[model samples]
Target chain A: MMAVRSTFGRTGNHPDILAGLVFIVVGALGLWAGRDLRVGAAAMMGPGYLPLIISSLIVFIGLIVTIMGLVRDNERLDVIRLRPLLIILVAVAGFAYAAESLGFILAAIWLIGVGSMADRETRLREVAASIVVLTTFGILVFIVGLGVQMKLGPF
Target chain B: MEFLDSLILGFSTAATPTNLLFCLMGALLGTLIGVLPGIGPTATLAILLPITFFLPPLAALIMLAGIFYGAQYGGSTTAILVNLPGEASSVVTAIDGYQMAKQGRAGAALAVAALGSFFAGTVSTLGLAIAGPALATLALSFGPAEYFSLTIFGLLCATVLASGSVIKAIAMICIGLLLGMVGTDVNSGSERLTFGATELFDGVEFVVIAVGLFGIAEIIVNLETPELRGLIAAKISRLWPTRDDFRRAWPAVLRGTGLGTFLGILPGGGATLSAFSAYTLEKKVSRDPRRFGKGAIEGVAGPEAANNAGAQSSFIPLLTLGIPSNAVMAMLLGAMTIHGITPGPAVIQNQPELFWGLVASMWIGNAMLLVINLPLIGLWVRLLTVPYRLLYPAILLFCCVGVYSVSNRAFDVALAVGFGFLGYLFRKAKCEPGPLLLGFVLGPLLETNLRRALLISQGDPSVFIQRPISLALLVAALGLLVLMVVPAVRKTREEAFVDEES
Candidate 1:
């Protein structure tokens, strides 16, 4: 495992390689997902015509990009700090689930409270104050003023 | 006489109390975000887009247009005072504007930028008023083949002109086209790529993709980097430029305005590209280029005018031809779709008020920006001191609420989370998300036109080449592709984007 990791790190452009792999996977998935749909001629295109064409083009581009990545000058990927990445997503995901069931107050709190932790410099007092202030502001502006159709509480 | 009558109708419609108030709100909000770094006009517009659904169509457009040009005005404020460009379009403004500030001419730089921008805004708005009907008249004659060819030209030009690796941008556009095909096919009524999710039958909401890619992804990226804050460099002793400064800046402003108006009408050309190009032009044309980085008034004046003109004129393509030039125009197109307005040649003939009202509001918004930016510079400077830690949480709340409010579906918000993660991946891969958006908005239109054209031609592909307009557009797209392959033009393209990368 260690030898494999070192070899991967020493290889050509990591970002391009990753990007190419992603494109190939997504294109293949698109082709697989649309296998059931029909593809008529250009005059009368079936549901899968454009999707299949686009998927094949994507895969073709991905192949070229991957080849270029292998032959081009070496460039390392940027340092991936997963802490903020994961925390922000989790905060947003939590808000999505809680918004309808738990109501705006809890959802807004979950969003701001957890989302604030993504930053290393976040102070507890600052987070607490922001949650209170922003929640009230969101309620007034989004719900009351703009009529965004969100319930204020679980009731 | 007809043009004058239309202008009068526009002024009457835009000068209503409600439209005027929304215009002021947009300009004020625009300047606020423009003064603060880290947030961009695209993300702000995305966040605010859902809220506009509650508004009347003309009022909403008026406000959004205000925010777009108002940002250009406010960005130069921070670029001059603190040596930090609050928006990408103001990067060149900071080079000499900051030097002027350090030389105790901050007030002069600020005044010239605001006045020059106001002038450019007026000219571009007039250009819009004059060019709108003529373009619409020409567009009325287009058939399906012409539409398909135009979309192809627009997409190709967008990829070529956008600052990034062309192949990567093209790949991103393909991904966007695939995503746009996910919902039920209108022709056959069968889902293409829903992955077994039923909520996606109606298709992915534009707001969800926008807020996810621009808003949520932006916040995450901002968190990864440490913040840099610059202190205000000098005191404002004077608020007006001297006679000599005016003499030097007027010609540059005139040149910048002309260039910006023309460039902004092109696919993927807007404030940032226009500003960079204007700066290059000024440097090339100057007798003594050494004075550029050393507090030349023309340096501050030229790009400032160009960016404002570019920001305003970019609306022309969307309004007349129903084709968006960039990401922000894509958002506007999305907004128009939500309002049940199909933006095409018919818009001017059928709903004359909407087009003219928006044009009038842009000029009014520019005048408001001058008043908001000049005397209130100190207030905006103070706003720059607000830290990202305190700011991002509010923005995050807006993102969550904004996504949720779109159709009031938890599923959409959840989908946005997925796009947010994908956006993070794309950023790591050095792929721009802007072209993806442009492709997504145009995909359904492209597909519909292609089918119609082929159906008429009985599967014969020669119809595309047979139509004069369609053939010309395809030839232009092919020419652009060939230019990219040439080593000299490729080198120049790479050099043009170097400032953006840095």
Candidate 2:
């Protein structure tokens, strides 16, 4: 069903192709993972029954989508921008790791400082102000007011 | 007589000073966040949901409800002033609203949007009071078969209506259903997808997924587009709509309210679809269709009213059938569960005060929004001038602290980061997260009920078709699938989303 198979060498890649491939792979993985689970009868469905049905459907849908991409005119895939993507993800992961060890205020300040670097122009003064205000607000609203259990300082 | 008595009881419960304060607080926070670009109602609701855990359930629910409709009202403010749709539902509003701003009618457009939203909010609150209990009564008759069928219809509609390739949307839903099954199987006591991790026992937290997909992914996307956003520099000519503008707006508001109220009650339909459909209807009804997008007062008035009304009435399915029509409603459902309150047909009977109080507070909250939005227009416009560089960092920090505080688990935060990455990938692939969220919420319910229905029929697959209601729902789902696959209808759906995308 590769309608565009003749033109494949000429046309650039389309996002729909990649998306379809992802779905098919994910569906196949899900089916394989649940291979051992019993499907059970209609009157008594096992845990695998719905999963099996859904994964198969997912694969079917994925194939249809892949065909649609082949037959229909599609938008070309945009180059992935890794700079901001990495900065934002790594910054958040850093917070997840640091928030517990360094306490709320330090973790938050560290998060802001690193996250601010993702932007083209970084303003230190604004980042500093945001840190002070957000920390006070977080402490006031979350810690003291809501009584969410978090350490105030590493001290 | 019974309705009036219940109304009186509701007023007494909601009119208390504390609830009024929480309502005001929610409205204020909702407007503030709604005015800010990049943070939509879904993100704001998810970020604020954990905080509701500490408050009394009634007050917590009242505040959350206030935030929802309040955000709808405030979303139009940014759309009109800066040509930025602060929320997805307001995307249609930005079309004509920004044109009005360029024509030096910004004040008129903003005023009309606010007035139309307040009117729609009032009418829909009335609708909730009148129709909510009746729907609950209707839902009381639903068996496991009916529930399974209803969820099937909801998931299918959600997949179809989502703004992307229908196949991709269905795939997302299937993936969501799979992700939702990660925890232990309630009936069999075996984990479905969990790979023997202790954290997998309870399944993944809804908050973790919500924050990651909406909050974190949004920040990542916004980071890539670092262009300076300029505010519309049009002078404030008049602070209110002219007489002629009022004449054009009132009828549109009425039509919008009717459209929104009707669609909002449907399982998969809500504010975003209502706004789009309302704009399309307004264009169809207009004698001069060319004026529809170029600063037509009806364009601003209709979609704003429709969005707010749809937002309010979306609660019908949530409170009555315990089915969330959208992501924000799902978060609210999660909040209610945390408070040990199961929202369903019995909720009205078992928690009358909580039910009626939420209803009463909605009306009060609408009044508060009218007061807060009009006078604070200038302040919000100034908020648009704030640099995104500073603002996004604060948003990310709050997201981190919020997710961590959910269970004080670092593991959850890590999990949230992972979802955020996946969310970004989905966005790149043009797959929508909305159907995924809806499917995830409805997954367990669908599974549990399908099993139960089969159990009752001794595993006969025909059990779903034998019952009238179940059969009707399944037929509707099938019909929707057929409609979605039809070439003409698929083209129209794609065109609608494409118009909004540009």
Encode model 1's per-residue lDDT on B235-352: one tens digit a residue. Answer: 9999999999999999999989998999999999989899999999999999999999999999999999999999989999999999998999999998999899988889999999
lDDT of each: 0.91, 0.84
Question: lDDT by residue for model 2 over B298-398, one digit each (tens)?
Answer: 99999999988999999988998898887788888878987889888899888888889999999899999998998888887788777777778878877
Q: Alpha carbon lDDT of residue B427, candidate 1?
A: 87
Instruction: List chain B TM-scores, each candidate.
Output: 0.99, 0.97
**Consecutive 10-residue window with the lowest summed lDDT within model 1 chain A:** A1-10
Off by over 4 Å in 2: A1-13, A152-155
Q: What TM-score would you give candidate 1 relative to the actual structure?
A: 0.98
Residue B331 deviation, candidate 2, in Å?
Answer: 1.7
Q: On a 0 to 100 scale, what is the lDDT of residue B2 in model 2?
A: 91
- Give candidate 2's root-mean-square deviation (CA, Å): 3.5
